[model samples]
Target: MSLPENFNGWEHLQKTYMLEYNRRVDKFFSDVQGNGDLSNVRSSLKLACRLVDGDNEATWSLRTSLFFDVIGYSRKNLSIFYGSNIDTALPVAGHPQLFLYFSQDSQAVPLNGKRLDHEKSCRLTRYACKSGQSLPAVTKANLLDIAHEIKAQFVSGGKGIIYTAGKLSVSYTDPANGFPKGTRWLVNSKSEAIELYGKLCNVIDRPFDINKMNVNTPEKDSTTQVINTTDTILGKQYKQYAYRPVANLRFRYAYVSFGGSASPIFLIDTTFRNTALIA
Candidate 1:
């Protein structure tokens, strides 16, 4: 089916995708059951349904591709459908798509003992697709190809938490300009904000103090605002300065798992919103 030219909101779009995905899954299972391969049909059906539910429109195409791929692989590897170990065997035997999905869906713990945060597994799946690598090959390679790249890009050395791209508006108090408000340095990305923060720290003789606070609001509207305040004393005179971040810094981690073991893989990508700096 096709969407209407005036398709209104995301709710409608999501419902359409959900309906189509369910129809495809139901038909696929019915056809499989009719073929007399009734072995572990219930288990297979349950897993197949998971591909659609709880997923968004962005991953719909990839999940559809994975669904058909699983069917094709299962046909070639018939032994996976039978026996007492069918439940376990079917996922890892020759079905990389299923294995990847299970791994990405499960929770993972890093060395810090904190649950990693990030976007849905679809982000990594899309990343893998963009690299032109087959999911089966990535699975067989223990997912290192994607894992290594993700770590290089997102993870901070000695800091277990992942750093996702975010927009930040930092404004510092500048009394010399006769402005009551702080001079703002609007940065587009987290990396750029950090770089600017480092530069600010260098100019002062004493260490710049960093204070972080969580805004008290609804979870969906919650944001982390970091304040950097510095007190510099020159002879008898002292200057107190403060910088505040007005935008939200979303924190999340992505993980890849196989054989029940999960490892942090990547962070969700976010675009930086640009705001004009106030002098």
Candidate 2:
């Protein structure tokens, strides 16, 4: 086939270029809908950007483009489905388009100030995600740090106990913040939320505020006003954990199965999300 005038000369080469971009863009969307960590997606794209620019000197001469949103994964991943016609770096319509837009799927408006999704911030540190400095040698922040890292996101009210028996985090009454109608817990995933709800089932003797909010329906005129913390506005009580912000998190670990038995030491999970030895 003959090349057209606007073909950019290297037709065969251009096809190759677009091919890889197409594959990456497709994979990118798959990960997002899957609700994969935004960081992981970016890491992959940054890797692709490196791989596509391989040893080819001429390819480097090309723009070698991609888009990333500090909020979610790079937009380049989504744009592929629409044929790379994206403006490259501009924000999209309702949300930031070319760039990453921050908004809740439930709400139509874009997140104005600080929108949030669980970034890979789920790293495991020696101490814990909530409590820092369990040990000196283990300094790197891990995934567990995610919960604590985002603690400040919620407004402080009073004192309460956070149930930690299973996967779901125990949310509390944020009467200070419109109870469940206003704000919720800082959970890492829906699984974590489930764990909290499961626990609530057995202990719903009292009208626990946070859990009630999650399970029950908010009043019809429930327009969220301020994101501040309050003291017993709805039903349940209120409490707060002092907030702290952490940039990076660690999720890996080391383990030994046999404590008494003589066995070789072993390196535990790779990414830090999975557990190596459960005793």
Candidate 3:
């Protein structure tokens, strides 16, 4: 049967959401086509993605409010899936947002467009998976090679390849990995991740250790070089006068498969107020 007119890809994210949400998603997807991270869009497209995003509230919201009038699929006989920790072969989290599968038995995997893209990323990363326990550096082109190895897994593998765009004049051989080819690396945070494409171009033909280039992987594990806020992302010095000391700060890190990873660094984990100290 055909999907409802209103209930469609990015058309209807949640069942009970406001009518204006459709407009928001439409604008979001269209604008997201440009660059940066489109993680939120992935959650809206498929149930698997949504589950990985941990949007359980939305599930109840759909059942009660998103009646068939909008999305017939939501009320279909088919069971909706949101992976769990038991799923091993499947990455811990759905690609892009780092979601884990939850089911005990293997059912038909969702082969949607975004899933295909994520699978492509996983394939290349797996193929390049070497003897080293540590993560390796990679480029966009070489990632394609890895993707080619497991093309069938990706629904759109044969149709097209993933692309990354930026204004920093950034480019990478295996741009898929965001790192350049033959470069040893590790991805530790988002800031360094942002530099991957540009760095790849700089190291165009140089042969380097893949492990050395890992974004989040620390050098030799003992590398406790604290990231200073004033200088880099982790530096506590970053919160000078812009944000009040009591205000929570946003902390961000980059994951290899997922575009941008973030967390909220509260100013104080505990709170103590002594009125006596004041005046």
Candidate 4:
């Protein structure tokens, strides 16, 4: 496509870019929707960012801080989607994703005529789609579907849990196949997420009175007037109530690309009990 010789407008180009930008922002919130910890998403993104550029801590910190706001926006839109609990890390070398599950064991101790031993067992599964030509298309619309597929293939309907890229993660849920309700708890732990919503107002310099509002809906008698500009109406009463903000976000790819192959690489790690006796 060639640019129009006399075209002086950038609106068309801006619109196209905005479409992609909106898609990315939507996908990010959708994926991080559930009751899981934002920290996991933060950690995963942190590690992924590090793997991409390890020497710039300041840059990474700033970027992730911005990401924290994006996550807040996602949570605001869909408060029901419990966040993810799976442990996520930068995809291992030659791997596109990883899966993990935990199990507990108990044994009788021989010391006091009774044995009591507790142990936790964990399993790791890796899925690599970096090879082969049958690679499925990864796009904004189907991002959530792909995350669901990852859980279906690795976790099945079992207790196994897996981590994903956190894009469209809101779609990965099953009544019988997912983590417990309490497993993805947040609101209590994320004061910053809530504060970010308030920050939006202050950051934009929206001046509202602190004393004249009630979070429980202020009546006319107690309503406070807010002034945005010197000549603007000072009689306009404003009441402050907290609401979630929609995040502006960008989705990034963390996979390695090689000649001709575009599928994500897969790895599966199985755990087995060692029962062999020493001869």
List candidate 4 segments past 4 Å from native: 31-121, 124-150, 153-279
Residue-wise C-alpha lDDT for candidate 2, range 45-154, written one tens digit per residue: 44444324344655443324432233233431231222133424211111100110111222322333122222110111122212233433221233223223222221
List the candidate 3 regions with Cα displacement exceeding 4 Å.
1-19, 31-279
What does the lDDT read for residue 229 in candidate 2?
A: 57
Q: Candidate 1 at 231: error in angstroms?
A: 41
TM-score for all predictions? 0.20, 0.25, 0.18, 0.20
The best-first sequence of candidates by TM-score reads 2, 4, 1, 3
In model 1, which residue pairs have backbone atoms overlapping below 3 Å? 117-252, 117-253, 118-252, 118-253
Tens digit of per-residue lDDT, candidate 4, span 155-223: 433323322111110111111221112122111113322332232223222332333222221122221
Q: How accurate locally is residue 166 in candidate 2, as Cα lDDT from 0 to 100?
A: 15
For residues 142-221, write the lDDT of model 1, one tens digit per residue.
Answer: 44544343334333442223223223444433222111232333444545545433433331111332332111222232
Please report how far candidate 4 places residue 185 from its true position, in Å.
16
- What's the TM for model 1? 0.20
Query: For model 3, what is the C-alpha lDDT against the true structure?
Result: 0.28
Q: After superposition, how far is residue 84 of candidate 1 from its true place, in Å?
A: 25
Tell me the whole-model lDDT of each prediction, alpha carbons only. 0.34, 0.30, 0.28, 0.28
The regions of model 1 sitting more than 4 angstroms off are: 1-118, 123-137, 140-142, 161-253, 257-279
